[model samples]
Target: MFNLFGRSRKSNLRPPRAPGDTVRAKDLAYLQKWSASRAGVEGFVEPETIVNEMSVVFVDGTGEWTRRRIGGPKGIDAVFQGTGVPLYFAEETGYPQRMRDRIEKDRIVRERLKQRERRARLEQERER
Candidate 1:
């Protein structure tokens, strides 16, 4: 039960969470409807559906937003209905290479920085 510096460990594990993350199909529909109305709103559809216990991310004129757990392509379709937005698969409209590269680089850079910072902090603490 003892932690570093002899204090009692305050859960190295994830915090206790409330049950059942809900993703209302209607909210997703609303988001999609909004995206279709906005300019420069690019939609990227993975070859398969995205699944996790957490949330589904979408973009609109207001930027990125997420709704809790809506499963499958059918679920997304429902979002379109709610939002009055059309969902287009990326494969359908050949995407610009640079834009894809830009997105890739952005994500990679963020991940790299996070790892590096974590390593650096760990190293520094060890040396102290």
Candidate 2:
């Protein structure tokens, strides 16, 4: 591909983002907003594993949770400094069972919805 300036797209390549790349301003703002919206919540810092990148997960007493990718442990601390909630290392303290159950339930609901949609499509094809 070529650009209007007559330069090939490959020539205008940008550097790939690393795991420790700086967090975006919008993401920081969102994190602040989400934490402020909750009255009581706990933050969990999860280290980067094979399956997932480093992230921070916030959970309230009612099991409602929000997760976002953070830069690292230092970034996690800096982000949640204003929130007067406890932060824990997920490696030491496993995620709450409620969060796990909620994830599973959501997965099951999505699968069921997909199955229903597939059946509906099959029925429509049969009618045609």
Candidate 3:
């Protein structure tokens, strides 16, 4: 028997949490830190996908963002209600452009730093 692309036909299964299951304490702590940051934040409930768990993302007005897996949508709403900020379904609002821009800026900065480090190392080798 041959399988195309060497992929299994079995469904990838994840155990669902019970309805009464509580959200993780660490997730709550992260949410708290983001809420208390310099700028106000908005919450987005991200749905479960094949490669990722159900999670929440908080994007501050200044474009700072954090994301973590949470128990479920209800648990996310319950946890963030105390923040007094608007919460939206990821499907409804999608991700904010500011968050995307912030991530891109960080990536560029990191790449530039790496190039500088590599250049310094090459210079040191040449001087040896």
Candidate 4:
């Protein structure tokens, strides 16, 4: 039973990877440096989707985080093999509350900075 496109349904089960989706040396280096420099870092593996490759996010104690594409699950194991960094499946265990809190805090700080800039602009207009 051929579909309208005359292709097997199984063929569409998995989408092809986008160009440059595979892991690179730079991505590995960045992940290594960031994880090594931070304290109490935890690795969270995010599954690959149509728009993105499988990636890992490392969050430090302070909630500072960085994400980089990890070729696949095996790559993740290889990267953290001797690093001693704990790894979690992001899908199984959602992101930590601290990460969320940190994001909100940063957002608030940015808003305040924008408000200050606007106020300064208004003052300058009044002076003119």
Clashes of each: 6, 0, 0, 0
The 10-residue segment of model 2 with minimum total lDDT is: 14-23
What TM-scores do the predictions have? 0.37, 0.68, 0.79, 0.80
Put the candidates in TM-score order, highest first: 4, 3, 2, 1
RMSD of 2: 6.5
Predicted structure with the largest lDDT when compared to the true one: 4
Task: Please write out the lDDT profile of model 2 over residues 1-128, one tens digit for every residue.
Answer: 99899988765563332255533456567777877787667888887654455677888766678887665555665666645557888889988887788788889999999999999999999999
TM-score quality measure for candidate 3: 0.79
lDDT for 94 in candidate 3 is 88
Q: What is the C-alpha RMSD of each candidate to the true structure, in Å?
A: 12.0, 6.5, 4.7, 4.3
Pick by TM-score: which candidate is best? 4
Residue pairs clashing, model 3: none
For model 4, residues 22-109, the per-residue Cα lDDT tens digits are 5466766787788889898998989977656688889999999988777666667765774567989999999998899999999999
Model 1 CA deviation exceeding 4 Å by range: 1-39, 44-77, 94-99, 111-115, 122-128
lDDT of 1 by residue, 1-128 (tens): 98766755554343322233333646565555656666555444433322233233454444443333444455555544555444555456544455556668879999999999999999999999
Superposing every Cα of model 3 onto the true structure, what RMSD results? 4.7
Candidate 2 residue-wise lDDT at 18: 28
